[model samples]
Each structure stands twice: as structure tokens, then as C-alpha cells.
Target: MQAPINIALVGNPNSGKSSLFNALTGLNQKVSNFPGVTVDKKTGIAHISPSLKANVIDLPGTYSLYPKSADEYVTYEVLINPANADKPDIILIIADASNLKRNLLFCSQIIDLKVPVIIALTMMDLARKKGVEIDLAGLERELGVPVVAINPRRNKGMAELKKNIELVVKEKHAPARDFIDSNVLAPDAIREIKTYFPSRSDYAALHVAVNSEELPFLNDGQKQGIKQALQEHHFNKTKVQAEEIMQRYARIKHIMKASVVETDPLQKQLRSEKIDDLLLHRFWGYAILLVVMFLLFQSIFWLASYPMDWIEGGFGALSGWLSQVLPDNKISDLFINGIIAGLGGIAVFVPQIMILFGLITVLEDTGYMSRISFLTDRLMRQVGLNGKSVMPLISGVACAVPAIMATRTIENRKERLITIMVTPLMSCSARLPIYTVMIALVIPDNRVLGILSLQGLVMMGLYLLGFFMAIFIAAIMKMLVKMKEKSYFIMELPVYRAPRWKNVGTTMVEKAKIFITDAGKVIMVISVILWFLASYGPSSKMDPVHEKYEKLIVEHPDQSEELNKAFQSEKLANSYAGILGHAIEPAIRPLGFDWKIGIALITSFAAREVFVGTMATLYSVGETPEDNDATLRQKMSAATWPDGRPVYDLATGLSLMLFYAFAMQCMSTLAIVKRETKSWKLPAVQFVYMTALAYICSFIAYILFK
Candidate 1:
């Protein structure tokens, strides 16, 4: 039996590290927490050859070894702590070739750590297109380690990369000399720290001296000793770091001079710049942004409809076929009505979600997404946020939990807090099903200009409404919070290129799988519980309904089928779900929702998308109405009040949609908010304020439209 070698993949953000990981691990990766931290740890098996295999751990992307945020801290902790389980046997450093100078600074730092390292130069294609040429062999000789040029996106150089990795792991090839003169710069401090970390490399000991307080592996005694050494030596951490960078870059320039060449010394402007000029124009930029966003929503509707309908019809047919194949019993009912119906509700929306994520990924791959952040900065700054805040806000359209996490990148505490507080106001994908169903019922599909869909226009309008509301709320918060801090926005715009179809496809698939595995579990459990509640009632209420149906069936055998269906509906109205919904019906009636809708509102506090599954269970699964052929949309459209007025009329549908748009209905999002904010106070306040706003807006909507 052979033990698997451990490989650590580390690189800067947007350095093609993840692409390489995906290429190596494919679908074998497992994502979980790293030991005790909430930061994600993604590891998978990479088979180097027939007999050699490696375990690859993708560390969080970091700019340097110094710890700044939780992410960077994790990367540093794993690398420096010898006792840590993830300390790799070998290191693969991904360096962006297009920006070789900045990339090599970190590469040089790692080389001094004396670990077996193989450099993988990514983005070489883009570098070549920009007239940048690198001598791979010269780079290897200069760095004193094996360097392989690879493009993970195109599957280029994989065999060579694998061959190099195998050789490095077997041969134990590491740099023989330090890239920087650490002994001359931090001589006294490094000697002192080495007394404690006796086995550590000189550079590792120096890092311990620089940031002993934040490193978890340091005991109190070691920390006190390191701090004392720093004080006694009069160590200047910043000045030392600056000098180290200069020394590394000085060496890098010598290396680049011999190994690199640029055909165009006068930098040629890329097509990306030309596009940005028009797309970032002061007035037209915003107008163009509005159009792009509108088109995104419109495309979701136009492109996803075919697949959505196919999924819907497939599920409907499956439900019918399963009913015929299995005997009519509680198990059958659970499978068809409870699990299938609830799952179907979620499955139909998968197309829309995938489409949205795919388009967003394409926009990101082509470099347009950064331009959006650049364009929105001015407007965002006016409202107490800067341009960087726009990324999280825009990302909220997918999910608020990660969107809030993204705020960690904003260094300004005030701006970050404001962004976190107002980000949930963006219409996330969880609310998409509710909006889609309601819009289909209330808004006609007729196109306004023969090219624009009215339903899509409504969807776009709802999204814009949320954005405007977020801005307004942030401005108000800025006035009330009394926060004063220096803020700046620094961003790099990547050169425009054709969309990387493989990357886009990978993201689309991953997102779809996440939704099914993550959100589907929540929906399934809630559905089963709701099915029980809606399936039974007190014996006094349920027994009589069954008895009356039996008596009516014998006397009027010809009408027995239709009569029995009606009896079941009557029984369900007396069921526990009905009782609870009716209890709250009076209070919600003012906002235009009835008892059934009230039940959905209660269950949906767990997640916004659960409203669709809840409705499916209560309407279709719980009552197997005579019109079993109809879809959820059809059933809701067919629903009528006691007086024969449609239940899903324009006013009622709009009211419910608006409620979901504004309300803090997702418990998972609230929990994430508490985790990120480190307090229950903000999430508590957020829930109260959002619910109040939802109610008030829904009340007004019902009054005006009904």
C-alpha cells in the first residue's frame, strides 16, 4: 500500500488556480470546512500516473503570505503550521503570466520556504496575444525550480504539468538558495524565533516574528518571546517587507530581462478599452447598463421557457405514471404527492437559475463585469458606498448569503457594513420562482416593441425596484450611523477576449448541482411535514367527510369520482394546515392573500423558494383535484373565491410577488447575516424592518390594483 502525496495549490485571486484545480480533480472534489474554520476547504484526488496519486488542496486565493482577512489567514496558517494536517508535501504555485512581475513577488517568497515547488504559468495565451513572450526554461533556471507553462482552460500542457509534478514529488526538488537575503534584513528577529521554531526555515521563522499574534500555532510563551525579540531588535515590519519586495523585484527584473520580451514596447490598447469607453460614458453608461440588465432578464424568460415547460410536463407525466404503477396507499401518496410534487416545483426553476448563472459567468469571463463595477462606483459613492460595493449588490441576485460574505473585500468598515445591510434588498434567485409564477398569471406575454416580452419587462422592473430601494435604504443608513472612515476604490480591468465557454459551462453545472444538493434538502423536508399536516385532521372532522363520501358514492355511483374529489377538498380545508392558514387569514386578507397563501407565507420563512413547493403541496398533492392534468400555474390561475372571482387576479398576484421581493423570508440568509455581522441585533432588526416594508407595500398594491 502506498501513501498518497499531498499537494497544495496556492495563487492570487483570478490567477487561473481554480481552473487548474478543476482540470486536475474534475468531479472528484469535496468541499467542507478546514478543521475548525468556516472558510471552505476544497480537496480532491489527482492521479499522476498508474501507480502515483496525489491529494490536491486548493487554498483560498491570497495576495501575499501576510494575513489580512479570514481567507488570507487560512492560507498562511496552512502553509506555516507544520503540525497542521493540510501542510502539503509539495506546492504548486499558479502564476499569471500576463502579469509576471507582480506574480513573481509571491513566487519568490515561496521559493525561500524550501518546499518542493513547481510553478505553473497560466494565461500564457493571453500574454502572447498581448505581445508578451516568456522563456520558460530561463524562468526555471532563474527561480531554481521546475516551471511548466500551462493553460488549464484549454487543457494545454496537462501531460507536461503532470510529468513535472511527478518528478518533483519523487525527486524532492526544492530551491537550494533563498531568493531574498532574509539573514541580512531581519537577522536578530529571525535568530530569536528560530530558537522556538527550531526546525522551521529562516523565512518561516521570520513570518512568525512578523505576525505571531494572529498565528494560531503559537503558544503564549512563544508569542511573548517573539514580541520581545521584535521589541528588543527594534524590528520595523513594514520597512522590512518593503525592502524584501524591492530585493525580490530587483532579482525578478534581472530574470525578466534575459527571459522575457515584448514586441510592442508602446502598449497597444485592447478592444476592451474601446468597448469600455462607450459602456462607461457618464450618461450613456447607466442607460446601457439598464438595457443590459433588461436583456438579461428578458433572455432568462425567452431562453429558459422551452426547457422549463419540458421539465414541468415531464414531472407531471411522471406523477401520473407513478400513480398508475404503484398501489394507492400512504407510501404511494408520499412519493407522488409529497416528494415528487415538491421536487417538481424546484426542478422547473432549474432552467432559469442555470441560465442566469451562465450569463453572469460569461459576462465575467469576457471582462465586462469589472467595467460594470467601474461604471457604478460614482453612483454608489454618492449613496455611502463605493464601486466595489456594487459587486456584492449585483451578486445578491444569486444569493444573499455569499453576497454578504463578499463584503469582506471592502476594507472600509462603514461602507462594508452599509453594503451588507442593504444587499438583501436585491431580488435574489430564491424569489425568482415566486415572481415568475405571479408574473405569468398577472402580466400578459404580449411584447411591447415586437421584440420585448412584457413578462420579462415586469421581471426587470421588479429587479430595478429592488436596486433603487437598496440605494435609498443605504443613504438613510449613512445619515443615521455616524460612521467616518477613509475609502478608496482600486480595480484592474482585464483585457477583453472571447468568452471562455468551458469556464462558463463549469460554473453553470456547479451552480445547478449546489441548488439541488443544498436547497433541495430544505424543500423536501418541509414538504413532507406539510403533507402530513394537510393530509389529516381531527377524527371528528375527517371521519364524517369520509363517511358522507361513501354514502354519496353508493347512491350516485355515476358521479362518484367527481363527488369523491370534492369530499377530499372539503376534508383538507378542515385539516391542520387549513386551520393554521385560516387563523392568520384575517390578518393577511388586507394584503390580498387568502388562507392557502397564508400557509405558504408561514412555511416560506425557511426559504423564499419554498413558497412554490408549499403551494404545490397544499393545492395539488394535498388535494389531488379532478384537473390533475393542469400545471401549478394552471391550477393557481383556475383558483376562484367563493363568489367565483379569480383568486390569482392581477392585484393578488402582484401583492404576493411584492411581499416576497421585500421580505427577509430566508432563514439561511439570516443565519449567515448573524455569522458575518457577529451579532443577532442586526439580523433581528433586518427581519423586522423588511417584513414591515413588505406588508406596507403589499397593502398599498392591493388597494390600488384590486
Candidate 2:
């Protein structure tokens, strides 16, 4: 079989490129990192024809070929770097019709790359609504490239798009004309670089001359040669870039004037603008944001309760049945107490995780996610960041790894660093399992205003706490980290649209799968280890517990069940896990953590969600055979300290929640942090400061609640 032809999808942010990619690829897509970069590379297989299956690569959305951030650099390298492995055979530029003038800047740049290019025009309805209309033939004639109008959302014009793609690939279509004269910008520099890169167009050579130092494909010798060539020509890259943009826009203005018509020169305000007037109102915007957040957090509990209960009960019955039928041996103990118990703990929270990601997806699909950045810009600026920082912080709620990677978009170095440092402070979904279980254990299930759930209110409060604390830390870091650069918040608010339910559903399912597959592996391994440690101990200590329990059962035959319970508890306390937990108990006791919780604390350094699984496994191992049917929550609620006080009361529960909130407890998070900052020192300092803060805050929470 022949290799699939590579087609790169390129467009500006929110230009409907992703939707088009999804429409073309359907369920064939996969996400991975761009070869050496952390930026997500989304690719898929699209059958353009029965004979032609294309490899569709959705490159990072960039406004111009001039790269600014890491993501933009990836797109630039893939296009301009001669040696890049995934370089496209053709470029599919998705242009937003409603904003054709602004979108043309990027389209024109891509066309000038002298590659096979197709313009998939989208949002024609949105354009017509804005009183702008374009003649498709004229647009194609002006740009000298094939232009296909498409509505990926409604699945319109896709057949024509596929047909055009197949035609272009088979024939090796290339743009007939350059949109702008590249020689006028830096003639000598382009001529000099083109000699070394004989096949490269003048435009491509100009870009290479301008960005030679940063382009990864160029060897040191080539870079030095390019540098010498540029100096010999007396090339001013910045001046040339400014001039080139001016010339392109001037030409674009003429093309728009000729091919486009507006029914009203002074058009009425768009429907989106009218709605934004209300939704983005100074006071109302913030108020609506809070209400939206409150509802989102509340819905996590309200919508997920039924499914969560079903899962919990299902696991309980499974454990009971396994206990009853499985032969009484260590193998059965490992299966029931180790594996099933741990898996059950996490599986029960899948509903909440799915709901959280689904709702977040809804926010993004409707375009309101950007409005949030707009609203938070003023506040973020006060904390030494900008609106761009809000995106990463908000994404942190989903997972810190990608969220931290998202920080690469921030152009300011100091702001980016501070954002990366404090992003983990946001309560990610991994903490959801911990939060939900803790809130259920401690907070009342009653309503606060005769309708709003008090437990949900507490859940919202915990999320708010993390966000606020992150802001506070960013403020402090701003004063300390010294890098002098003027910062600006420049962003275009995308018009709101109805939430794409398909995309939302896909996201929810994708994120849930990631959660289960990634976190489940760790939980299963830890659970088996914990079960062994909790089930067996030094034979000398184990023998004593067995002898004492056997004697007590004989002496008091009526209380044989109680004697067995005591026997299990005694054996567990002297077990390997218990010994490790006891070593840390004295240190954590002031924060209301018992030896078992201390065990969880150590194990869960692997992941915050692992705390729940660790607790489930420990408690399951300590359960008497008669208690096999009890839920993890029930087992935990019935737990007691030596003095018989409930182990997971309001104080301890809140304290544990607060600790997880501030602690750098996730090894994955730390690893990503190191990757992002590219420094072990930053992550080390992050771990130290966060752990200390967790300890101090947990102590205070325990004191106040107790």
C-alpha cells in the first residue's frame, strides 16, 4: 500500500479549522505531541477518495507565518523546515468568511509558500448575517488558488471539499501567483539564502533568513552562513516584516473592495455584539460568571449522584459475591481487597469526572470560554499576568499537564513562568474524586437556600479557594521574580454560538477514557502492593494476633465476630503498610491524619486520586468477612482512632482536602512542570514551597474545624 498523502490543516484561532478536521476525520483522529515539543499535534485519516486516503494533520492555529510562541513555532517549523518528518504534501487553510479581511492575511502567507493550497471557506452564514457577501469565483480568481465554501458544522459543502482535495493531491496543485512580492522586502537576503536552498521559493528563503537562529533544522554551519548573508545584505528583518504586512493588507484591501459587497456600509450591530452587551456587562458579566460557575459545580453532584451510587453499589455487591465464592486464600484477598477495592474507588467517580469535562467543553464550544479570559484580564493583570494567562489557569482545572503546556502561548517570559508555577494550585479534575468523597463525608447534604445544595456550595467553595490562592501566590511571585518587560493583553473575542453537542460529547468521552486508563494503571499497581502490606506482617507479630484472637474466640464463643474484627485490626496495624504509616503518623497527627491516612498520603504522591483508592484498599483489608458488602464510604465512616472517635469527621476531612489542594502531590504534575520550565530547580522549589504551604494550611484547617 502507498503511504497516505499528508494534508496540513492551518488557520487562525477559532477559524473553524478544528471543526472541519473533525468533520473530515470523524472517529479516525488521534492526539500526540509534536515530535520534540509539548504542543498537541492532532492528526487523523480522511478518505478523500476510495483510492486516496489522506493523513490529515491539524497544525496549531497561528495568525501569521511569523512565529511568536511555541505552538506557532511548531507550525512554522513543519512548513519551513526542510527536514521535518511530518511536513505536509498540501496545505488546507480554513478561512472564516465572516472575518475574511483579517483571515486573508494568513491565507495569503500560506499561498506564498508555493505549495499546493486549498481554501476551505467557513462561516458564510455568519458572514451573511454581518451583511457581507463574497463572490466565490472572484475570490478564487483573486487568490489564484482553488476555494471551496464549506460549513463543517452543518456538514454542507464537504463533498465538494473532498473532491477538491483529491483533485489537488492527484495533480499536485500549486498557487498560480504570489500574494505579495517577497523580493521587495529583502531582495539581497532572499537571493543569498536561496542559493544555499536552491529549491526554496524567495518567500520561504526570506523567512529562513529572518528566523535562521531559531529554526531547528539548520545546522550551526548553515546558521552561521545565513547570519553572514543577512549582515552582508544589511537586512532589517523587523522592518521587512512590517513592510510585508503593510503591502499584503494594502493589496487585500483592493481585493476585498472588488470582490466583496456589503448591503449596508454602516451595518447594524451583530446579534453576538448585542448579546455581548448584556453578557459582557462590567458588573453583570462577573455576576453571571459566578452564577455559571456555581451551577457548573452544583451540576457535578446533582447529575452524577444517581450514576455514582449505582457504581458504588455495583462494586459493593461484586466484592460481596467474590468474597462469598472465591476460595479463602491470599489470592482471593488480593483480588477482592487489592484490585477490586481500588478500581471501585476510582470507577465510582467517573460520572463526576465526565460531567466536569463535558461542562467545560460546553463553555469552550459556545465561545464563552474566551469571554471569561476577557472578564478576568483586569484581575489577572493585577497578579502579574494577562488575559492569555487565564486560559492556562482555567485549563488547569481539567489537568495541570496540558494546562501548563498551554502556558506556552503567553509571550511574556516572567508572566509565563509565574503562570506555570501557580497553575497546579488550580483544583484539577484529579482532585475531584478526593473533593467529592470528602465533601460527602463531612458537609451536610441539605439545601442552603431551599434549592441550592449545601454540599455543592462547599464543592464550589473548594474550587474557588484554589483559584483565589493561585491568584494570591501569583501576586507575591510578581513582586519577587524580576523580569522587566511591558505586558499587554491583546485578544479578539470570538462570537458566541450554540454549544456543539457532538464536540462536547466527544471531549467528555475522551477525557473520561484518559482518566481511567492513565490513573487506573497506577491505582491497580498500588492497590495490590497495599493489600499485601495490609494483609501480611512479620510472622512473629502475625502469630501473636492469630493466637490472641483464637483464644478469645474459644473463651467467648458468643463474641467470635467481635474477636475476629479485633484480630484483623491488630494484624493490619503490625503489617508492613502500618509500620510505614506509623513512622509518619506523629508528624501528621496535628493535622488530624491517622497512620492509615498517612499511608494514603505517601502512596498518593503518585497521584491525588490515588488517595481514595489507597483508603479503599486499606479499609477493605481491615474489614471482617461479614462487612464485605459495605461501601468504601461506609467502611471509612465507621473507622475510628484508638480513642474511638470517628476518624473522618468534619475536621479531618476538611484538613485532608486542604492538604491535597496545596500539596505538590502528583508526580506527573511535577514531571510536566520540569518539562515546561526545563529546569529541575523550579520543580524542586515548587515541590518544597507547595508541600510546606499544604502542611501549614492543613494544620490551621484542622484546628479551626476541630
Candidate 3:
């Protein structure tokens, strides 16, 4: 047995590093956090040969050795600390061939770390589209390292890339050329640094001298020594860094001139720029974005309805058939009402989740997602959020845990905190079922202006409502939270390209699978616990109902079925779940929620999606066998108060929808918020504020409409 070689895939942001990683690793990848850090670290296995396998770690995107954010610092940390677990034996730097100059800066910095290096040149097709050409051999000669042109998205030049990796790892081929004369740059500091860390390369020693205070690997005495050395040499950190960059660029300029032929990629606003001209126009871009938002919410219903119906019908039939065949006992009841109902609740929404993720993925693949940030920069600033916050907030429409995690890219502490606090206010996919069911029950299915769906219009309105609420809250936070640090938005807009269908399909399937499996596990457990609570109570307390039902069954033998259903309903109302729901009933009564809704609300803190499962199980357990075939929507619709007024009329439905929209119902999101902010205070404040808002809004809606 042989240990796989450790290979680090490093590159600047938007340099196609992800494309290369996907090509190399395929589906054999895992995501975990770094030790003692919450930032995500992705690692995968890449087979290079019969005997050679590589554990390729996709390092964080960084432009230079000087890190600015937590993500970039992770990259720099791993590169400098040899003892780190993700330390690489070989480094493959993916560079955008079309934007070689900017990409080369990072490459030059990495090469000086004295590791075996290979340049995986991507975007060659884009380069050629702009009438540019690259001399691969000439580049290899100029850089003193292997340079392989690869189109990872198309799997082009992968074989050569693998060959280069094997060659570099086997030969330990360090770069033979140095772009900067380090001795000339800082002779005294370099000499002093190497004396303390004798094994460090000249460039590595120079870095230690420059960043000793910031580097975790350096000991206090070594840091003090480096500081002393710097002071004795009269070294200026900024001045030295500037000179180093200038010298490296001077060398890079010559290399690029010799080996690369440039054409004016912006000569006539290529197709991508042309599209951006309209999509990024000061006036039309905003309008187009709003239209896109409207269509996305509408399609979540229109496209997902077919599959949702099929899944619901299939599950309902299965539940009914199982009830018919299996004897009606506690075990059977638990299986049908608890596990099956819970899983089915989540499964029914799988289509909607798929559609939502697919749409988001499409926008990302088309490069329009970045344009959204560009368009929203000024608007976001007015609300005290960075433009980068817009992506996470919009992505919140899919989920908040990831969106909260996405706040890591916001370098400004105050802005990042504000984003994490307000992101959950944006309606997520978990809220879809609530919104969809409520809208169908309340909002009409008729068309407006003959081209728009009235029900869908409501759905879009809910999403917009959340977004506007986020901005409004952000504005308030902007006024409240004091900040000393400045924030800026720097993004590289990827050129437009046709969506890679294979990758898109893979993402959709993978995301959908994750959603169903993850939610299914949590929901099933919660449903089972809920079922037990709803099915059984203190025998002392429930004995009377049982005796009453027994008497009714004997007294009216011809009506045994109706009596039995009544008995079960009475038993549930006396059960533990019922008692708990009743305890909170008064608090929610003004907002139009009954005891059953209270139970759902309490159980849903584990996850917002659990509300569906809770409702399904609660209502299913209370239903007569004759109505077993009815869908959840049908059952909910047929529900009524004791006075015969419908329980789920327009007012109650809209109130519930608005409650879920604004509530901080997901525990996962809260935990992530706590982790990102590193304080329980923020999550506490967030939960309190959101819950209060949801209640107030729901109360207002119920008052106005009822």
C-alpha cells in the first residue's frame, strides 16, 4: 500500500480553480472545516497513475501571500506552515490564460516558496476567442516550471496535467528561476531571519521577517529576533513589499511579452460585455434583476407543481394501503403517521427545492450572479451592507446556514455582522412549503393581466417582502452598530459562457439529494417523537376518554367507525402533544393560530421544514380512515373550528405564511450565526427580534383581514 501524494490546488479568485478541482476530483470529494477554524476546507482524491494517487486539497482563493480575509488567511497559513495537515508536496496553480498578468502575481509568490510547481493554464478558449495566443513551451521556459494548458470544464488537457503532476512530485522539481533578487531586496533581514530559521528558503525567510507578528508558526523569541533584525536594517515592510512586487512584475512583463500574444479582449465589448451592457446598465439592469426575481418565485410553483402532486399522491396512496393491510396498532400507527408522514412531508417539497437550486445554479453559470452584486453595490451600501452581502442574501432564498457561512467573504466586521443578523429574514426554500400551501389555500389561482399567475404573484410578493424587510432592518442596524473599519467590494466578473450542462445537472441532483436526505433524517426523528406525544398521554388522565369511547362503540354498533374516529380524536386532544400545544395556544390565539398550530410552531424550531411534517402527522392522526386518501392540502382545507367556521381561511393562512417568512425558525441557522459571530448574544438578539417581528406582523394581518 502507498500513501497518496498531497497536492494543493492554489489560485486567485475566479481563476477557474474550482473547474480544475472538479475535473481532477470528480465526485470523490469531502468538505470539512479546518482544525480550530470554521472555514470550509474541501479535499478530494485524484488518481494520477497505477501506483500514484494524489490527495488534492483545494486551497482558498487568494491573490497574494498577504491575506485580507479569514478565507485567504487559511490559504497563506497552510502554505507557510509546513507542519499543517494540508501541506502540499506539489502545488498546481490554475491560472486564467486570458488574464495572465493578474494571475501571475500569485503564481510568482507561490513559486518563491520553493515548492515543486506546475501551472495549469485555463481559459485558453476564451483567450483564443479574443484573438490571443499562448506559447506553452515558451511560457514553461520563461517561468522555469511546467505549464500545461487545460480546459477543465471540457476535460481537455487533463492527461497532460496529470503527467506534469507525476513528473513534478517524482522529481521534486522546484522552480529553477527566481523572479525577484531577494538578496538585493532585503539582504540584512533575510540573513538575520535565516540565521534563526536555518532551513527556511530565502524567500520564506524574507516573508517571516515581514510578517512575523502575524504568522502563527513563529515563536515569540523568533518574532522578537525578526523585529530586531528589521529595526537594525531599517527595513520598511510596506516599502519592501512594494519593491518586491515591482521587481516581480518587471520579470513577469518580460515573460508575458515573450511568450504571450495579446489582443484587445475589450476592443468591441465581446458578447459577454454586450450582454452586461444591458444587464448591468444603470437603469435597465435593476429592472431586469427585478423581473428575474419575479420569474424565479413564479417558476418554483409552476415547474414544481407536477412532481409535487405526484409525490403527494403516491405517498397518500401508500399510507392508505398500508393502513388497509396492516392491523391498526400502535406500531402500525407510528409507522404510518410518524415516519412515513415525516419523510413524505419533506419528499413532496423535493421538486421545489430542485427547481430553486437549479435556477440559482443557472444564474451562477451564466455569470449573471456576479452582475447582481455589481448592480446592487450602491443599494446595499445605503443599507450598510457590502455588495458581497447581496449574493448571500439572495442565496438565502435557498437556505440561511450557507448564506450565514457565506458572510465570511465580507471583510468588514460590522457589515458581516449585519448581514448575518438580517439574512434569515429573506425567505428560504424551507419557507416554500408554507408559502405555497398557504397561498394556494388563500390566494386565487386566477391570472392577472392574462400573463401572470395570481397565486404566484403572492409568492413573489412574499419573497420581496422578506428582501425589503432585510434592507429595512439593515438600515436600522447601520445606525445602531458603530464601525471603525472601512469596507470595499472587489469582484472579477467572469465572461459569459454557455452553462456546462453536465456540471449543472450534477449540482442539481447533488443539491436535491442533500436536501431530501438531510431533512428526512431530522424530520423523521422529530415526527416520531411528536407522534408518541400525540398518541399517548398519562393513563390516569386519558382513561375517561377510553371508557367513553368504549361505551359509545357498544351503544351504537352501526356507527362504530365514526365513534372510533371520534375516540381517537378525543384521545389526541388529551395527549401530551395536545397539552403542550394548548399551553401556548393563548399566546398565538391573537395571531389566528390554534393549539395544533402551536405544536407545529414549537416542534419547528429544529427546522422550519418540520412544520409541514408536524402538521401532516398531527392532522393525519386525527383523521377518520375514510378520508385517508385525501391530500394534506385537502385535509387542511376541510378543517374547521367547533363553530363550523373554516380554520384555514384567508386571514389565518396569510398570517401563518407571514409568520414563517419572518421567523427565525431554523436552529441550524442560529447555530451558524453563533459560530460566525462567535457570540451567543448576536443569535439571541436575532432570534428575539425576528420572533417578535413575525408575531407582530401576523397579529396585524389577522386583525386587518379577519
- The local distance difference test score of each candidate is 0.86, 0.91, 0.88
Over 599-678, each residue of candidate 1 has an lDDT whose tens digit, in order, gives 99999988888899998887775455335546788878877777889999899988998898899998888898888888
Worst 10 residues of 1 by lDDT: 621-630
The clash count for each model shown is: 0, 0, 0
User: Top lDDT: which candidate number?
Assistant: 2
**Which residue runs of candidate 3 sit more than 4 Å off their true CA positions?**
263-266
Q: Residue 284's C-alpha lDDT in candidate 1?
A: 90
What is the per-residue lDDT of model 2 for residues 111-173, given as tens digits with 9 covering 90 to 100? 999999999999999889889999999989999999999999899999999899888877886
**10 residues in a row with least lDDT, candidate 3:** 261-270
After TM-score superposition, what is the CA distance of residue 588 in candidate 3 from its true location, in Å?
Answer: 0.4
CA-only RMSD, every prediction: 2.7, 1.2, 1.6
| Alpha-carbon deviation at 675 in model 3, angstroms | 1.4
TM-score of 3: 0.97
How does each model score on TM-score? Answer: 0.93, 0.98, 0.97
For model 3, which pairs clash?
none
User: Cα deviation in Å at residue 195, candidate 1?
Assistant: 1.4
